[model samples]
Target: MSSMKTYAHVQAKTTRWKLDSKAIDQGIAYGLMIAALFVTYLVH
Candidate 1:
């Protein structure tokens, strides 16, 4: 029973961690897009 509880806790932790990394990935993508736009604007 205790092992099952531990497994549940770890599962939740990993799920949350995955969500956090996904958010970070989205942020980086947005940053790159903005940077590309800025560069284009400067070139124009």
Candidate 2:
């Protein structure tokens, strides 16, 4: 029974971690794209 509880706890933690990492990855990609566009416009 204790092992099952531990497994559940780890599962929940990893799921949350995955979601947070996914959000971070998306944010970084968006920021990089915006920066690239801004640099291109500035060269004009």
TM-score of each: 0.93, 0.86
User: How many residue pairs clash in all the candidates, one count each?
Assistant: 0, 0
lDDT of 1 at 9: 100
Model 2 residue 28 lDDT score? 100
lDDT of each: 1.00, 1.00
Residue 26 deviation, candidate 2, in Å? 0.6
Model 2, span 1-44: residue lDDT tens: 99999999999999999999999999999999999999999998
Model 1 worst lDDT run, 10 consecutive residues:
1-10
Error of 2 at 22 (Å): 0.8
| Local accuracy of candidate 1 as per-residue lDDT tens digits, 1-44 | 99999999999999999999999999999999999999999999
